[model samples]
Target: MRLSTDSPSINDSKSSNKHNANELAPRPTSIKDTGIQESVLLELMLKHLLSGGVLTKAQLVNKMGITGGIIQELFDKAKGLAWVENRQSSAEGHMRFALSEAGDRYAKQASMKSGYRGLVPVPLAQYSKICRLQSSRRNPITFEMLQNGLKALVLPNDLLHKIGPALNSSRPVLIYGPPGTGKSYLCRNLNATLGDSVLIPYAIAIGTEVIQVYDPQLHHAVDNNNESAQLDLVQGHDPRWIECKRPLRITGGELTAEMLEVQFDSHSRTYMAPIQLKANNGILLLDDLGRQRISAKQLFNRWIIPMEERRDFLSMQSGEHFEIPFELILLFSTNLNPNELVDDAFLRRLGYKIHFDALDEPLYRKIWFQVCEEQGLSCSEEMFQHLVNDYHHLLEKPLIPCYPRDLLGIMGDQISFMELKPVVTKALIAEAWSIYFVQA
Candidate 1:
């Protein structure tokens, strides 16, 4: 049965505990606020009661993520139909409830169809609405914004300016460079520069199929414990939506072509939305691009249609298809040559193809001191010069930005192992450098 937003669900009318308007996580006040069908919710409640055997009204509310009054209304409805019975009073003002024989049979049939029984899921239609409303393209990035976001990192002005515009375009970014040139680092900073935040649902329901969306690993929630925001929760924003920083999801060499599609568990009768689905309205970085088990050509082929249409078609085992929004900054970072990985036609699809080259002597030296300062080690100019001139120049090795941090890390490790104060000496530099570079 369709859930009507016009009437307040049982608990919403009685609850006086209101949330502040500015509160980041506004608790859903009613069944309508959850944005899923009431019939689906009724079945979920029955399943919970069947599995739990007996549960308090408050416990059911907590388990279902619905307000107490709504749970009360559901119990009343179930009791009237004899689908559930109030066994006894578990606690003061809390009634213990259990499924009736009919309810058990109904739950069994429901479980046979789909074993989902958890948080009341937001309908896919509602999820799509929220995603489109909070699309990353809506938030524009300025040069100043990019600079402020990456202020912690030492990036050159030329590179900064180029990145500013590239990110603003909101198209595919190809960050190609040799290893240790900070291609991945730049992509991370660029993602931060997108600024603002987006709302992500806890889970999405398509018919009876529920697909979980909130991942603690991928989604970083904003600190919303402010007094004013808490006070504003009285009216309540939808609890299903979580205010999170625009996600920066990274995948490396382990990624395969199958991972790009919606994954279903036949045993559990549930669907897990793909990475791109979770990555909607943010940046999805494919790190070590060409190194994925799936060849670059195969990967590009998978993305081409989504790239052009700005939507992806995901299929279920039952041959059901869903067209989901494809609105994220797709970033591809690789140490390998772009030409060798994907042909020119695919390269044309990328809006910005920037190359990160090894650092020059001046930049290299600047980074050397920075690494020293960060590592709490003293920098000796003589030692740095000796290493650069004698080792880098003499050996014909290019100075890469990552070398300073890496070499100093080894020096620090050695000092720690020996219980010596960390200092850059010619001997120490030589030792670290020797360990860092492979013998030709």
Candidate 2:
């Protein structure tokens, strides 16, 4: 079986293999490769020392993902300042250094200012540069690539044609359709088709303040451990950057305007990069568009300038404003009509407005059989015809793609309860339909 490049198991196995000397060459051998200031390194060193009384130079290198030479250089500087002292010789013949009283006092001050004690953050300038380098525009998705990406889904040929060009437009898409027509599902699958991975920063440093960007919940780290290790041997990536599958984030009715701005965590003395920033190199999907707590007009107006300029302005607590790349595939999914939610001005901003209508009889029947096959239940042509001609046509109920899967699940439950064999019979389906739909 083929494993995805982003699989952690694959990455771990690769990382475990011995690497060639030239391959090892890519690993960060100096502070410059880390893309962090020396002062920040020094502060990080001090903070790390606070954990254990003493640490060998090698330990510091592993903890900080820095080179030995750089760690030694920082250690010498700290020793010169009377911040650290060689406490004892270790079994490996390396001297273990402990923080001096002065160093301990300095570390306390550093901790008070910002409690961040992880791998060093890349400077905002460096992060912005990296973002530009990995910008989504540079890699235009082709129709063939999208076809391969969504090959698993049973998408119609016409819809596939529409999706291909919509993705190429590099503008926000509005997928308006009735509920259960797979608007959100299609957007999600489109994200899967984006192909290669991009690196995302754990956090970014803007002057003294740090904005955390890597969201554990959102960012999926690629496991190509061997490849990453080999890559490091030849040329090291900044430790601050994580190798991740391009993010595809979705927010629904619960979304609010406040979420669009930089969220400052006073307790941590740091900031959380908003959803848009986190989705910089990926797709940002606003599912259920008109249903947000904030009005659809409010959201549309807020995005107008940014969408036009292809850049976003974010502010820190100090009111310092900066422009960040708005390089992402923006998607808006809604069951509500776009005409009702957005006017011509806002509509113009949306590149492709695709509509998903209720499924027709033939497609609905195919999906019914597909669902029955998946559920390990025998498909009955007689029963399927009964549903279409009796339950649906008789009642004037439109065919929804989701009904097969949902009705099948309901039927499965009833079958289990009554201790009957799992099969789609006309009687069984009728009973499930009665339970599924009630008089309003």
Candidate 3:
């Protein structure tokens, strides 16, 4: 995808100046500034021409995510080597080019070396610097910002106060609570508090090894038409880096040890970056912490250094180790007891340990009415009382936040199925409660 010169979200605090200044890596002026060797750039161009067959200069610029001038320089070099030849000019007056017989052979050899045929990658050193710079320049979270970000959710002011400082600290947060208490939902919304956009490269290069960093599934691009036009008038924004909202990535019980490391594809000869690396300058939530495929102790051991030093170590297939800034909010959410999952020593390393409990009657009622409004059903005080007194209190079930939405959803489904008006009746509540909760 092409990069845009989008301004950061205005809600961000003034403390983000450092980040905003260096957020966009200046557009490279030459192949040397690209930080990629000439031979590597040639191979990349050859591979694109080989796969696409007879492409225009504009097409190569778009596919390579580089400036047209750099593409021209590469084209000139290729012409001298007889690896590429000029074709008929396009209707738009753009010069078209195609690979020579020898260029096709060279591209095949390049593919055999590594099949990665996408945007030219940022150098590992440049990427590492950007990660560290953005991490250190994060805007401090305020109580007002936190409250404003999570205004849609029904949460206590005390909890907001606890979370605001923890986020500003930029340290690991341990949120332990019972199931259905909204820990996961709360963590997801925390990204909204970080109002600024971040630059994520499509990929990063360590010598010849390429690691893909940007995932469309995780990073949501922001449009900056006005800013982009202004930037174009002055200096172009680097197409190599995509402007995106701060990413929020979550991994639950299915997480494996292998997922936390760089994955190399033998056939393709390219590397896929781990989740934490993708989550740089953002938040990474380890949901359902204690139930991962790997043991909790093993998981803790794997990240212990990164957690403490704020940098992680990853190795290429060749066993050459490199350091990347572990610049992200690491949030651990679990329904299980923290003590049982890990010893106090590990817990001590965490910045904050916040607890989430069952909601009280007032909070429960507030969420209930909110859900009723959301589901387009009339809220009934009598039916709500019956649900609380008969189902929750009688059955000794705690009033969890998720119960309102779940029970109301079940009732809405039944009403729709039975062709009845959208109303909350005691009988409907009973049926929904029965279906939602198992009876002994």
Candidate 4:
């Protein structure tokens, strides 16, 4: 069974809604959208269902990068939207879902909106709201705190001045560079440097209010109106630890549009936010910019509204759109050309674009020696020069300061393997580079 994009619904048609109010509906529902991006594989399965087929959780996990928990989240959302109809086993014990009238509409909308996208910066506007509340709750970081953090990084004088005002104001800061450039490291250190405790929200879900259907503890006191009855939110076993430390959501290229949306549960009927929502009030680093499945332009287009306005709109699966704050330090790390990646209009949203060029010879030497001393790798100046001058020529690559750190690591592994003395050698460095980095 395969779904067709051109030919509209061949079977499931939206049923007529007649009765209201006093009519005893099968289920009282709140049509909220679950902003989770349905994976291509899942979409394929749904398309198959439209043509007439079924999928088990096992088949789902095998096809998609999703796990049982995430799949359940999807099912719950669909069930709430009334997009699926449960059918009893005709001759087998297994149960399956068929596409419903609402499901067809949902599928069509999903197809129109779906495309594997990047999650980085997509949730900036959403996170902004979360941080505003989080910041207000934690109180703002004073100037002293900000200055101390900047000093600790030993940032260049020019860079410090450029970043200081941005920090003082509400403008977002971006750090662009290659891998191992310490982008994430410096951002994480912001919490400690700020001298403030960033609050991490424990998303206390109000269960799919099948009139309060989601029961986490089997005996939970979930109340929407009475702010007094606080739901005890626990991710895993025992439900004790709060896990409330402010988090830095480190996302690679696995980001998408749906992830920026809100979700609603059908069975247990609750909402689970995307990772960016969870990373609210903290730093969000799009570690590898060009590596995502989504085009850099497509992603930048969606972010334009949120970045400029400091507010992003989130659509509920129920088709309701709401605005959220865009609180976050959006860092785009890539090795690609900036001009080629994003245009002028897109670039304007970012307050600061700090490009970290390859370290010069002097800095390279300093970094190399610092790493070597820290790692306890024994090698004389003569040996270091020989390796740098020799292998670098053979490799035809510039002296990346990171090379020494990588070479030291390789030497350690070789020593451990061969049972050699505690020292590094040109041979070890050469062999490791050949194995790991010599591909290109």
Identify the leading candidate in terms of lDDT.
3
Give RMSD to native, each candidate. Answer: 7.1, 4.6, 3.9, 16.2
lDDT of 3 by residue, 148-255 (tens): 778899998899989888887756999999999999999999887676667889899888778899899999877441222221113435667777788999999989
| Candidate 1 least-lDDT 10 residues | 13-22
Better of 2 and 3 by TM-score: 3
**Model 1 lDDT tens row, 101-151:** 998998899888777776678777767766665665654666676777788
TM-score of each: 0.87, 0.88, 0.92, 0.56
* Residue 319 error, candidate 4, Å: 2.8
Query: What's the lDDT for all of these models?
Result: 0.76, 0.77, 0.84, 0.50
- Order of candidates by TM-score, top first? 3, 2, 1, 4
In order of listing, the candidates' clash counts read 11, 18, 0, 27
Order of quality (lDDT): 3, 2, 1, 4
Flag regions of model 2 displaced more than 4 Å.
Answer: 1-28, 90-94, 224-235
Error of 3 at 369 (Å): 0.5
Compared with the true structure, the alpha-carbon lDDT of candidate 3 equals: 0.84
Which residue pairs in candidate 3 collide? none
Q: lDDT score of model 1?
A: 0.76
Strongest candidate by TM-score = 3
